[model samples]
Structure formats: structure tokens, C-alpha cells
Target: MTKIGKKATLLAASALCLTGTNAVAEDAQTQAELDALRARVEALETNRAGPANGDFRIGNTTLDVYGYVKADFFYDFEFDQGDTAFVNVIGEPSAATDGTFGATIRQSRIGLRTSTPSGIGEIGGQLELDLFASNGTAELRLRHANITIGDRWLIGQYWTNFQPLDTYPTSVEFNGPVGIAFARVPQVRYTANLGSNTVFSTSIEENVSGSNSDDPVLTAAAEYNNGTYIARASALYGNAQTIDGATEVDQWGVTLSGSIRPWAGGLFQVNYIHGQALGPYLIGLGDAIVGGEANDVDGYTVEFRQDLSDKWNVGIAYGREDYDLATSTGTLAFTELETIHVNAFYKATDNLTLSAEYIYGERNDVNSGQDFDGNRIQVAAQLNF
Candidate 1:
């Protein structure tokens, strides 16, 4: 209990406390180094699996290669005209399979894209092609050769950035369009990103009219998109020629589209397009109005899809188009045509899928009126790298 004894005890206690604090500090430094080492290893592993480089680079140079090859076997039943035309065009065994079955490549495509940073902005190019023909001849499908001066300018032949993704429903047999897309053209586009989730874009491409060397088709669009929902409005205008010997200029229309996911993996989508087909702009029209050939096409589509899981998927879609024909005596209006399709898919594996689809269509034109009730059950195997 002496004063000297108390001072000695306090000094010993202070030295022990200092030693403990130094040990804790050393442990903290070691933990920080471990964390940094783990992060670096993860970055290297990710880069090894993906592109040689990571998602981005300091100079803003990036590249991606993506594509899939698919083949399927299908059999059509309920021999009808509406459906027969679609199947026969794709080299199907006519309305009657004739007890013979065959397989075809369903749009096996490959694409490459790369972008490099420029002083002003970024310049990029993309090329997509299909190589399924018997001779192994590849055909160019998507080609976007252009520069994006900031986010405001893009000159290329890529998507117009118009219609919503839902416009292209899930079809096992990918013949594409099937008279669904009123206008899908090539053009020079200007896109402005208002925010992270909002964008406005417009394009001008070669028109059917306005002289053999006139400006391209004109299109403008605005869209707001989040992870779950996308809403868009777009317009298309161009010169079109008439069915007869006359030519009228300046034909255009507007479109609205949106998509929503209601459940874990379910989606509902709809698109409305109303436009005029004047002069040359109606070149893509498929309605035969007898005496009325130059007619405006207007239509809409509704599509829905549900993915039960990675193995199962189902979808349904309906589309209708009305053509207002230009007749000699007067205007002849007809229902034109309508189509409904349902499809289901079962994934046999990550590289294989089995699909079945049913499509029904009706046309007001007698020749087109042949009830097209077609059913296709196909098994397809795909490889992706």
C-alpha cells in the first residue's frame, strides 16, 4: 500500500495497454491488405472469363462478340390458305407435310461490335451475319457503321430505336416480320440521353420517293425506360408512290409502345401503329385490293409471355392490320387481315430446346381468305460461345 508500489503498478498497466493497441493496429492493416488482394483476384478472374479486357478500359475501348446458331424440325397441320402461304414460303412441305419431315436452320446469326473513344466522342461499328445456307454462304443482316458524337449523334443502319422489344413476339420458327412490321428501314439517327433512363432519337433515311436520290426515311422517337417498364412514342414519314400512275409525297404516322413485367418472369406488351402509305412508302404492303392497290396500312399488336423457369416458357400474341385502298372510282376499305399466334417452349438443356407453336390468320381478300390454321412442333438445339 505504499506510494512507490502504486506508481509501479500504474506504469506496468500503461505498457501492457500500449502493447495491446499496437497488436490491434497491426491486425487491422493485415485485414485491409487481404481484402485488396481478394478484389484484385476477382477482377482478374472475371476478365479471363469474359473479354480479354474487362467491361471497360481507360481509353473507352470495348468489344463484344455474341451470337447463336439454331435449327428446328416442324410439322404443320390444318391445311389452310392463310397459314399455308407463310409455311410454304419458308420451304415447309406445303399445306400437307405429305408424311415427309425436314429440318431447317432458323436464322443462325453471329455479330461483332466494337467501340473506340475519339477526342469528340466514341466511334463504333457492328456487323451481323447468318451462315446456315447449304453452301455456307453468309449474308449480312445487321450493319451499323457510324460515329456517336457525344450521345446526340449516331449515323448508321441499325435499329431505328422506335418500336418496343415486345413488338417481336416469341416465335419458335423465326421467319421474321411475317407482314407484321409496317416500317423497318435504314437511316441516320440522332439520339440524346436526357437522363439515365430517358432518351430521345430521330433518323432520316432514303425514301421510296422524293426523287431517286431523295433523303432517307424520316423517323423520330422518345422513350422512358426503367428495369421493369418501357414507354415510347415514335413517328415515321416519307414519300410514297400510288398504285396507279400518280405520286403523292409526305406520308407518315405515329406509334406508341410499352412493356411491363407483372410476375417473377412474366411480361405483357402492346404496340399501336397508325400511319399512311403514300407514293413509294407502301412498297412493303402485302394486301391485294384487286383494283385498289395503293392503300394505307394501320394496325396494332398485343403480346404476353411467362417463363415458368429456365426450362419452360409460354407466349401468346395477336396482330391486326387494316388497309385502306386507293381505288379508281372511289375508296375501297377492307378488313385486310388479322393473325393470332401461341407458342410454348421447353428447354431440354442449356443448349437444347423443344418448341411448339400454333398460328391462325384470316384475310378479307378472297385469295387471302384461306383460313390459315398451322401448327408447328419443333425440336431445336443451340450452341452459344
Candidate 2:
């Protein structure tokens, strides 16, 4: 056997020997043997678990790793940046059937979760990572790590209370709706069960903006479920922003979301969020458009979903985001950017799923910020194990 393999076998034999002698060995021998056996077991466990690869059980918490893979096709229409509203545009554009297609890994993340023993309070947590093409590289899209204490207290990074669970739709592209919480920063939270399918949660977390400041974020939410329907409302406040010469003002937002299962296999979902800026950079500017004033930014989104059958589903999503530019050279706030996405999915079997989607987006300030309109049609198959 290899050297490492032989060592492992020897350690296992020693552990067996010590355990076997404990029944008749003296007290000193028993204690010494037990210590050696525990040390050997721990060493082996560490080697087996490896780094970043974990399947560990500590106390009542168990941990595992999991993730998903995805690919897509994309295209762009009205892909121009210069003046185009009055006559012939300054740039050439292409449509969906013009052979514009590409693939993306999107996100392939791994995470862990654990549950409390039966009849006791429960706790769990997870983390995910993804690849972003905009910066020509992979990035840490979802860095979440959290823990629960006695079902009432939680500490870690998770989804903000302001975002609802139903906001995440099943899509092939891996992109989510705007004005939604894809993930949250580290936080301390409290949860109370109000009985009969009702839960109330409040949290204090660092602002998601990776900036250098003392401002913190606060969130509070309540959720209710009554057989066929689930509804949630939440509020958030924070003074966080960009660090590279960009000053974001204090901000507050509100979200309301709900889901309903009207029939045996049909589902309905709705979500809304509104935010206001609270600093000099955000004063006097329209909330839906940019360049009107300082710190002016606001956005909203809506989505509808239908499950036609066990293997097919369709959805439409729309979102609008407006920002106030720091200078007049920047594009108009309202016409800065807008996006719409439509998608569908079909499951071929228990393990294979196929999806197709179309994405349309427009940017008002193409010269200053590379704003343009584009379209994408994507189809991919995924296997689950």
C-alpha cells in the first residue's frame, strides 16, 4: 500500500486495539487509550473532509455542499449608442435570429445547512458563488453564512427581510428580477412565531455596499400563510454606498409580496418595492430617472407566473431603475436604462430540464456609459443528481 494508505490502516488498527482493551484495562490505560483513539479519529476525519469540501457534523448541526450548472444564448437589437430617435441611427443593430448566441456558466455554488435534533429548536445556513461576464471574470455573487439559535435568534448573512421568498422565479438564465434581494450581508436577527402559519422577523445588518463608513442597515418583516396564500411585507433603512469617489445617501425601502396557489397545479405571484434617497446627492431628483439632482435613485419590479402542467411553465418580468447622475454630461435619469425579460421552461424527465428565454434591455446613455438596447434568446439542459 502507499505510505499514506498504510499509515491510515495502522491508525485504524491502533484505535481498534485501544477500544478492545478498554473493558479490562486499568483506569490509566483506559484513559490514555481513549485519548489516542479520539485523536486518531479526528485526524482521519479532517483529512477526509478536506478544505472547502465539508460534510461535517458538530453537535446537532450537519453540513453538506451543493450547487447547480447553467448555459444560455444571447442577442441584441437596436444596439446603438449615438442619436437614433429622429432618423437613421449611428450604429448597426441585429435581431434575435441573426446568429447571436453565447454560453455562460452563471453560478456553480456550494453550501451547507443543518437542523436541530427532533423536538428541539432548529437552525441552518447556506452560501453560493457565481460567475459574472460583465467584468470578464468570475465573482463572489452570494457570500452567505448564517446560524440559528433555538429558532428565535439568527446570526449570519442571508436574504434581507424586505425581500419575499416568492420573488425568485424558476428561470433558465439564472438572472433574477430587479428591486429584489438576491442575498444579504452579515447580520443579527430575531424571529418570533406568531402561531398558525405566521412569522415575524427583524434584523440589523451591515450595508451591502462595500464601503468604508459606520452606517448600518435595519430591516423588519412579517409573513403570513393561510393554506393557499402567503403574503409578506418588509422595510429597510441604511446609509451605505460606493467607496470610489461615489457617495450614496442614506436610503429606505419598502416591499410587499404575495403568492397564491389558485388550483391544484396553478400558481400566482406578485412583488413590489420602492426606495428613496436621503442625502444631498439624492435631493430634488426624480426617483425614477437620473441627472435631475444629487443622490436621486428609485426602482420597482413586477412578475407573473403560470404552471401550465407538471413539465411546463411560463413567466414574464418587468423592471425599471432610475438614477440621478452627478453631472449633466451623464445621460437623462429617467431614460438611463430599462429592462424586460420573458421566459419559459419544460422538464423532459425527473433529472433533465430544458429552458428557453428572451431578454430585452435599453440604455439611454450609451456614449457616456455604454447604454444600448439588446435582446437574448437562450436554451440549455441541466442534469440533477
Candidate 3:
């Protein structure tokens, strides 16, 4: 073996090593270029498919459409004015004594929601509609049209601030317990989150109908919610006006509502309201001011709901409204109204439900000293998407 032989062997080995390193670098560069090309193709495909899928994106905003289809069949043991009972108006002296059966899809609803990124925060808006029309025909009616700016301010028509939405019981009826504060009106609302479990909100809303006044209804509410227990308190102040613009009455109301989960899948809710001239704020049972005098009213609702299993649940509720018209010179159509509801719901699938309810109501006329009782059975099927 000679020095020249060793040197030649070392040079040949180094040349082979350099050639292998260059080949490896070339292969890595080729793979990087392929990945870049694949990503560009995917971007192009996504841009082309967005519009065809009905989910077109605008800037940084996304829009979604959602709703449910619901059908209700009902039978009444006593004749009422319509398919659904007018519990407050059932005890008139001219009431009929015939049973009725009917069906309605007025509770079916549709909605659109949008979210957009802004410099201040995320801006969100929702428009919702249902088939509950004003003229007894099933026409689309606006249920909610509102915009939420950032996380604190909301403007447009939404649930009234005095209403305790969390306290509402599950029911098969389109309208839940009658004594619960329920109303949707145009409002300017502000919400503040106090830590993780509490919230405070206030709003000014439209109060009376055709009242030629500048003052609006004022409301404030506070709520505390942990995973299992919830509590809420709200207050309302508004004005009542007459049709002829002849008289106006000042009205105020306070509501205390709460719900407790005693055990897994069991909930108990109670709502109590006492007010002068609360008729307009309630479920439109009567006028807040009759004959230029404000009516003092008290209403309460108690509901117990139990979930027997993942797919089955039952609820029982009782509600009452009492009017103090003993000293009023006006003719009172109803002085006391009571209602009971027992309902069960079964989830056929993740997006479909079947429910049945038995509803019984009694109304008393203070002026006529007459009482009328009505009973109804309702069955409903709903599909949500």
C-alpha cells in the first residue's frame, strides 16, 4: 500500500459524499415547491365552492340561516274565539258552550344571523320571523330584529328587559305559562357582565300603543347564574294612555323570578309580579288603564320540570292573575284567571321532537259574578335545523 493509493481513495469518497448532499438538497427544494402549488390549488377551489354552497363569505363576516318547522293540533272542550284559547276573554256573559278542534302552524319560525369583525369588536345581528299574523291568517311576522354591537350594547326589537327568559318553563303550547312576563318591543339595551356568574341589564322600550307621549317604558334587571341555580329580579315603569288621548296613567311593576336545580335534570321555577297598570306588560290580557284608572294586578307562575331520561321530559305548571277591581267603577270583564298545564316531550331524534299537553283554564268576571271553565289538549311536532 502506498501514500498515493490512500489519497486517491479518500478523494473518491469525499466526491461521492458531496454528490449525495447536493441530491438531497435538490429533492427538498422540489418537495417545497409541490406543497406550495397544492396549497394554491386548494385556495382556488375553496373560493369557487363558497358561493355554490350558499355560504358565501364577505370580508371577515359569516352569515347563517336557522329555523324550525312546527305543527300544532289542539282540541278545546269549550268553544273559544280561536284555535288557541283566549284565557282572559273566555268568561264573558255571551260565551258559547260548544267544543272545537283546529290546527295551526303559527309557531313555525325562521331566522338569519350574521357576525362581522370590526375595529371596536364583533358586530352581530339577527332577524327572526314566525307565522303568527295579525289578521287570523298565517302570515310571516317579525319576532326579533336586532343588532348587537360589541358585547354590551344592543338595539332594535327583542325580548323586553323585564322578562326573565331563563325562568320560562318548557311547554308544548305555543305560549308558555300566561303569568310570565312576556313581551318583545323596540329597545335600546345595555348589558354588563359582572365576573363569570352575574349579569346586569337595562333598557328603554316602547310601552303603550298610540300614546302621544315622549316618555317610554323603562326596565332594569339583574341575574345570577351558576351551572345549576339561577336567580333574577327585574323592574318596569311605564305609562298607559287612552284611545282618545283624554287621559294618561302612570304605571309601575316589579318581578322576581328564580329557578333552582334540586338534582340532576330537575328544575323548579317561580315568577311573581305585582304592579299597577301591568296589563299592557303582561300577555295582553287586558288594558293597563281602564276608564282612566290604573288597575292593580298580581300574577304568579310556578313550574316544575323533570327530565326522566336523555330523550324524555315532563313539566307541570300553574299560573294565576288577580285584578283588584273592587273599588273601580269600570266594568271588569275578568277579575281572576287561573291556568294549569301538564306537558310531556319526547325527542325523536337530535332535531325532532314530539310533545303533548293538557291545559285547563278558568276565568271569573267580577262585574257579572260569572265563572267559565275551559280545557284543551294539544299535540305538537317540531323539526329544528
Candidate 4:
């Protein structure tokens, strides 16, 4: 290609990267338009990070509306876990039908984000909601409602600071594979950038598990990212008390997680967490305390993803959790949990994706004396904007 042609291609890529948008290719585009777009991209690139790049602008603030319309269809081969693949519920067979089919649009969500420049730096806010509030019904549930100041301070509800949010496994199921820390809570957090690729942060977060306690959770995290690889370490501690003020214990956890790009279109993600009185962070829905003592819990997840082509990709993930109960007064105490997902995705367009996945899960009860398993297959279509 000629020098002019090569420059045009680079100009287009810069435009897309700056705006975070996918633009349709045009056959009759002129050189003058490309030159103008390149100028805009260059200006934005020269500015500091976290600049508002949304298509809509009101005064100094830029607004972006995002989210996806997702529909999922699944069939349980052994036991039903509802629209969500909550495999931990698998239990001894009963009159409940084994082979059941279900579908839902509850995973669909919408969010609005806005950012404006300030003398201190930049101010931003986000409000996000989804339709998964009620079981078996689509009700709007709040996902994120937060404000950020100067890209360093965050206040309000968001993903818990301790979760490895970036390294979560990719799956067609809304719930994904479990055995990982996952929670959303209100908090005030401050972050310090060590350089272009490293950051340290701390927060005092609301203790959702401490209904009877008067203190907030303290969390700290450090992360390093250089485009091709990522690593993070996080720790949290707080006082938790059981309802009726029967028992109060120290609730704490530590997490190590990372993602690596091993080859072109190939990625690997792994995470490990160990804690006591984990609360809702453990998606297994287990109690933070059992029999007047904090439960010791450990969980991990690993996944690999490979791209077959520009339009197709596949991923496989395994997750597990083990519990050490200080006291077990019944035979139904859960001792272990495991789950797996094998999934494939095809992008029909820049904004639409179709996917299919197979899910398998197991739970061990009463000191691993009894085991239950569940199998299911799922397919989904998602349209993002």
C-alpha cells in the first residue's frame, strides 16, 4: 500500500481506540474526513487518561449509555437450578423433575455513565441496573451507583474492592463458574498510581455480613498491568457478628489473581482466595458463620480462552471451594463445591454475540460423606450497544 493508504488505516484505528466505538466501514469516505478524524484522535491522546470519550456531550460532561440485551436458554439434565446455574443446590433426587428447560432475559442490563473535567481533575458517575432482582421474574436490580473523583477516589456502591473483577471466567451463563469472591457493596476508596502500569488502593467498605456489628470492612489492594499481562493481590478484614448477637468473629480474606496473554488470541486467567466468614463474597451462598464460629473457606478458579478465528472462540473453566466448619451439628453441612464450564462464542456482528456452553457441578455434604452432581447445557444471544 502507498504511504497515504497506510496512514489512513492508522487514522481509523486511532479513532476507534479513542472513542471506544465500532464504526461501520465506508466505501466512499474521503481523505479530508480521515484527516479530520485523525486530528481529533491526536488531541484526545495528548490529554490525560480517563477523559470522557462518549458520543454524547452536555456542557463539559460526556455521557455514555451501555449494556447488553441478553437472552439465555438452558436445559438441566439432572436437577434444576433455575435460570441461574446455581449448581450447589443439587441434592438427593426427589419428585422435582430432573430434565427441565428454562429461559430468561433477566441478565439483560443497562447503564449510564457521565464524566466532566474539574479543577482537581475529573468527576464521573455511573448508574447501572439489571433485571435479576427477583427469582423467576425480571425485576430491575441495581448493579452500580457510584461517583469517582479525579480517577483516584470512589464513593458509593460498586464491585467489592477485594474481588478479582478483571480475571473472572468468561461463560454464557449469567452466574458463571462459582468458587470465587463476588460481591457489590457501598464503600469509600482511594487509589494511588505508582506508574503507568501499577497502582495501590485501600477502602473502608460496608460490612454486609455484619448485621449486628458496628464496624466497616478494611480492604487493601495492589495491581500491576502492562497491556499483555495483569496481576493483583487484595486483602480484607472486619468484625462480623451473627444475628441475635450470638457470636462475633474476625472476618478476613486474601486473594491473588492474574491474567496472561500467552499467544495471539489466547488468554489464561486464574484466581485463589482463602478466608474466614467470607459472607456473600463466596457465591456458593454458604453461611459466613456456622455453629457459633467463623467458617474457614478457600476457593479458586482457572480458565483458558482461545480464538479459532475473528468470529469464533472457545473457553473452558474449572472452579472449586472447600469449607472447614468449626462445628457441624447436622448431616447436611456443605463441605465442598465444584463447577466447570466449556463454552464457545461466535460474533455475528460488532455488537452481537451468540454463545453455547455446557455446565457441570458438584457438592459434597456432611464431611464429604454424600455427593450430588448436576449437568446442564446453555445457549445465549447478546446484543451490546
Candidate 5:
């Protein structure tokens, strides 16, 4: 056997008996032996678990494979909202139903991560994909592909810097709430960590909104996290063009978000956003630009979570977005959208989970002078690897 292997075997044999008559010496020796045994067990798990536990090494680099296969079954009680509880569809009249049942595995995703030592620092990258393509087909969609230089620089496609990912609410649904800002874009980002509690990041990202924008968007954010508490602020600015490419408009946005854990197993999170011509970044809530001008919009999300037991946790989240659009004599558009989600997650096994959620969504049509709402019940089963 290899020298290291023999040493491990010998250590295991010597530490098999951890008790002795002498109190102090026995305590010290037993503690040392336990530490050695723990390290050996960790090494064994790292090597034996392979990709299952996302630990392994190849050559000079470490590679981790992680993701889960999630299948969701949902029943919509007012409108057929399909896989996602799209609140925008709630106010629409067509396809209205008393009940509609659907099942989808499109939320399932897989990722490969690599880290290696370099001259400057540790270089790492991630390539992740999911089966939730916009076309409704179960095609592979790129989630993130990024490379990190040291700890401060990131280059590639990833979450936009304007997104306060640290304080974002969690839900069983893919896109949790309506008022939250959500988008992934290609960008080059620079991050600065001040002391140990504060961080700042800035990026220039591609515009992927419905309103075409040839110019890149500039985004910046700052955050402070101290164990159980977090606070963040983010902003973005850019220029957009009409679909016909005839009109040009200015785009800008800002968001403030934070989270706090008061009790041992309880957490509260909230965020507020106000912006113009930023519908694309706000979960397609309202028009980014209309008639040569950017529409004004604001949104907020409030959430609370508590762990009931070691294997179960529950949460409730509420989100709402409002739009300020020109009210014409006969024009029609959405003025407000809101959603509420209450969910419970149960850990069935080390690698398996079960979850259920109830969602209520509402849409207010200003010009049409109508209000519509819908309810959804969803249950999901996920297997992690």
C-alpha cells in the first residue's frame, strides 16, 4: 500500500480505543485522536462520494458536480397559469378556467464547477443549465457561465449586479414573486470587499429586455452582511430603443433590499425598487417604454420564514408591482400586479425533499377598469445529487 494509506490504517488502529484510566492525559489523547479520525473521514468522503457530494480533484484542479431534478405538479383555480404562477395572466379573460392541472420538470438543473490554483490566486468557474427554455420546450437553457479572477473580478454570463441576490426571497416556484427584480445577463463585474462586513460590486451588462437596447447597461451594488443580518442597495442605467427602432429612451432603476434573522430559526427579508423603463429586469411586470417615453414603475417584496423542526421549514412571501402609465381615453394596460405565496418544505431524506405551496395572484387593469385574481396549489418533489 502507499505510505499515506498505511499511515491512515495505522492511525485508525491506534485510535480505536479512545478511553483510558488517567483523566487529563486520556482527554488530551482522545481529543487528538478524534480530530485525526474526523479529518480522515472527511478525506475519505471527499474521495469516495465523487460527484455525488460535489467533491473530487482532477490534475491540479478541483471539480464539483451539483444540481437537482425537481418535478412540480400544480393546479390553477381561476386561470391556466401553467408551470409558473404568472400573475399577468390573471387579469386576462381568455382561457379562464375553474381548475387546470399541469406538471413540469423544467425547473431541474445541473451544473459543473471548477477551481484551481493560479499565479495570482484561486481561479474558479461555473457552467450551469436547466430545462426551462422560453419556448416551453424542455430544451437546455444556460443559467450561468462565469469565470472568477481571484476574488474580485468575474467575466461571463451570470446574475446581473443590480440584483440583490443575497436578500432575495425564496419560494418553491421558479420565479418566486412578482415585485422582485430578476434577470441574468452577460457582464464583466468587479467586486471589492471592505473589511469583512461590507462588499461593493459594479458591472456593464448586455440589455436583454423586450425594448431593444444597443447600448450596454451599467449596474452597481453595495452590501453589508454580518452573520444573521444583511443590507443591500443596487442601481442600473442604460438606453433603450423601441421595437421599430424608431424612438430612443433613457432607462434607469434602483432597488433597496435586506434580510435579518431575529430568532434561531426565523428570518425576515424585504426589498423595494423604483425605476423607469426597467420592466425587463422586473420580471416583465410592465411596459419598459411606451410612446417614446419610459414608464415609471415601483415594486416591493416582503417575506418571513421559520424553521419548525430539523426536517421542516415554512415561509410566506408577498410581492407587488405598480406601474405609472399614461391614462388615455380608451387605452388599456396593467396598472398593478401582486402575488402572495405560502410554502412548506419537508426534508424526506438526505438527498430527497418534498414541498407544497399555495399562491394567490391579482392583476389590476386601470384602463379596462377591471380586477382579476387566481389561486394555485403546487407540490414538488426534488432529488439532489
Candidate 6:
């Protein structure tokens, strides 16, 4: 062979070898990528079977569990009811007997919450239950079952929009005060933030006490908060029908509530509600609309709390509800309800608290010139989880 031919042949062989080596390396890289993908698929399948962390998950949804365990021990000096005082009943002659001692865990509760991502917003739901049930038995009862679509809307059972939650006073009793507006009902609510400090909310809630009228109760509220202070005004309107279906009464109420921090570790809260037929919303103290005529009612509550130290606090609260009866007979049936609470709380740990409270309640029947009074002392231990 000529010298030029020999050199060309040698270069051609080197090129072929290089091309073969490149092909082998490419094949090995492809196999490594396939192995990585397969391992990732297996890991995801394992995770789908159960949650690796504390929270449960399914697809894009995440579920969390939470609640508290509480035990309350109480002694009644002027009433016999073993549970929290129902002022309306405790004021009756039948309940005037004294010397009752009781203990219960009925307030302990468990709840489940879930959040899932969606196209419009995050969908969230909660299911909560406690041991308060029918016939004074220790059975699970639903407290809240509701769903929220982002921050704007909510559906199902939740705290009524007509009340200000921030103004609620701390107390050992399950039913804190007589004059506080409290109710949880099935409803559809819309909430909007007007600015950094103002919020407006409205809802249409199911009226369990409305007689013949099928229309739901309407509620609206506006709240303003500026670091140390919060103020709110809420209103409700509904129709109540008599059981006979012969009479329909107009029911409505307006509530103004606020909380202010006067100094470091000191706070004050006040609330006032006045309207016609506010029985169901005002701790069931009286009939909203009694007889054929609607009852006009007024309620007021005031509370002050002072933090003594990082682990100790003291509070005092007073509440009253008064009703106006058009007929003399109605006056005898329902008249006035009032309550006072003084409490001290100690934080045993970050998740544990111990508290003691003295509660005094009174009721009066104006027509009969009869007054019933009750007093109770309660101690409670609560552990949060």
C-alpha cells in the first residue's frame, strides 16, 4: 500500500472507534434515567398508601386532627343541676334546692380539618364533636361541620355572624354568660375585607324556631381592628310563626360589641344587644316572640381581664337580659336573667391550664314577685393538643 492510503485507513478506524464509544455512553445515560424514574414512581406509590408525616394526605388534600381534653368539677350552693347552670331552669322553684356537686368531661372535643387545592381557591372543611348530647348522656354530638371556599365564603354549621367572638369572656363554665349572643347554625356566609383593619360579613342562617315562615334569618356584621382595639356591630332579622300557624311575628336584633386593651396585660370587653324576639340568640333565656305579640328584649355584658403574670390571669364578667311583656300573663312566665362570673386562671404549662371560677346567677318573675338565685363554684383543668 502507498503511504497516504495507510494514513487514511488509520484515521478512519479511529473515527469509527470514537463513534462506538459515544453510542455506549449515551445508552448507559439513558438506562440511569429510566432507573431514577422507576424509583421515583415506587416512592410515590408508597406515600400514597399512607402519610409519612403526622398529617394524613390523599392526592392534593391534607387532613389534620386537633382538639382539647377538659375536665370540670363544680359545686352548686343554690341549684341542683349537675351540669352547667341553665339560668332559665335554675331560676324555677323546682331547681331552688342546694348542695350539688358534679364532675364532667363533656366539654372535651375532637376535630378534623382538611384542605385541598382547587382551581378557584383552596377548599377547606372541619368536623368537630364533643360529648354533649341528648338526655344528659355522654355521647358524641356535632359542634361544627362546615366547609369554606377560600376566605370569602362558608357553608354549613358554624358560629353565628351576629355575635362578636373576640368579646367572649374567659370562664370555667361551658355557657359563659347569660347575655352573650351565642348560636351555631347551618348557614351560608360571605366575608370581605374592606381594608387592612376592617371586615364585613353577612349570612343567611336556618331559623330553627321560626314557626310557619320558611324564610331564613338574615345577619350582617362589620368589624374594625387596630392592634390594641376591636369594635363590631351586628344585626339580625327573621320571622317567627306561632305553632298554630295563625300568627307570624317579626324578629330582629342589633348588637354592638368591642374590646380594648387599656394597658399592657389589661383588657376590657363590652357588648349590648336590643331588639324584638331575641330568645333563641340570647342563650335561650326567654321566648323571642311570646304569644301573638313580639317580645322586646335588651341584653348587656361587660368583662375585664388582667394578666398578673406570664402564667396567671384574673377576670370578672357581668351580664343581664331583660324582656318586656305586653300581656300580664307573659310577664309571669318569663322576666329577667342575669349572671356574674369571677375567675382566675393558671397556666401549668404551654399546653395545660387550670382555672377556678365563681358564678352567680339570678332570675325574676315580675308578675309573681318571685326571685330565684343560684351560685356555683367551678374548677377546671384543660390540656390542649
TM-score for candidate 6, residues paired by index = 0.83
Cα RMSD to the true fold for all candidates: 16.7, 10.9, 16.4, 9.3, 11.4, 16.8
Q: What order do you get sorting by lDDT, best first?
A: 5, 4, 6, 3, 2, 1
Which 10 consecutive positions of candidate 3 have the poorest summed lDDT? Answer: 47-56
lDDT of each: 0.56, 0.57, 0.78, 0.83, 0.84, 0.80
lDDT (C-alpha) at residue 308 in model 6: 99
TM-score of each: 0.68, 0.67, 0.83, 0.83, 0.85, 0.83
Q: Which candidate is the best by lDDT?
A: 5
Question: Which stretches of candidate 3 lie above 4 Å from their native place?
Answer: 1-56, 93-95, 208-214, 326-332
Q: Which lDDT tens digits does candidate 2 get at residues 1-385?
A: 4333345567777766756766665777767877777686666564543233334446555555455555554443444211111101212332213343355555454455655455546555655555543454555565567777777888887766666765555555554434444445688999899999999999997764433346777899998988689888888887644444356555677777788887776666676655654221111222321233224445556667787888998888765555544322232322244556688888888867788776666545434555545555557776652
Cα shift from native, residue 121, model 2 (Å): 3.4
Runs in model 2 lying further than 4 Å from the true structure = 1-61, 77-100, 116-120, 123-125, 131-134, 138-142, 210-212, 241-248, 278-298, 322-336, 365-372
Residue 263 in model 1: lDDT: 80
Evaluate residue 217 in candidate 6 and report its C-alpha lDDT on the 0 to 100 scale: 91
Q: Candidate 1 lDDT, tens digit per residue, 1-385?
A: 3332333345455544655566666877655655565565444343332235323332456655667777766554443232122422222124444333546663678776667778877666666666534343444444344445566776655555544553455676553223344233456788888898998888886553322324456778888889698788888765554346355445666778888898899999887767665322221244323242334666677889999888999998877666666221112223444666788888887766677766655444333333333444445566653
Q: Using alpha carbons, what is the TM-score of model 4?
A: 0.83
In candidate 6, list every pair of residues with a backbone clash: 211-241, 277-288
Higher-scoring candidate on TM-score, 3 or 5: 5
lDDT (Cα, tens digit) per residue for candidate 3, span 1-385: 3332333345455555655666666877655655565564444344432432223344566666679999999987774536565676465435455777889898899998888879878898889999999877899999999999998999999999988899886778776667767788899999999888999999999874433345799999999999788989999887776767688888789999888999999999999999987876665365666667888889899999999999999999988888775322224467677888899999999999999999888877676787778888899999996
lDDT of 1: 0.56
lDDT of 5 by residue, 125-162 (tens): 99999999986888899999999989999999999898
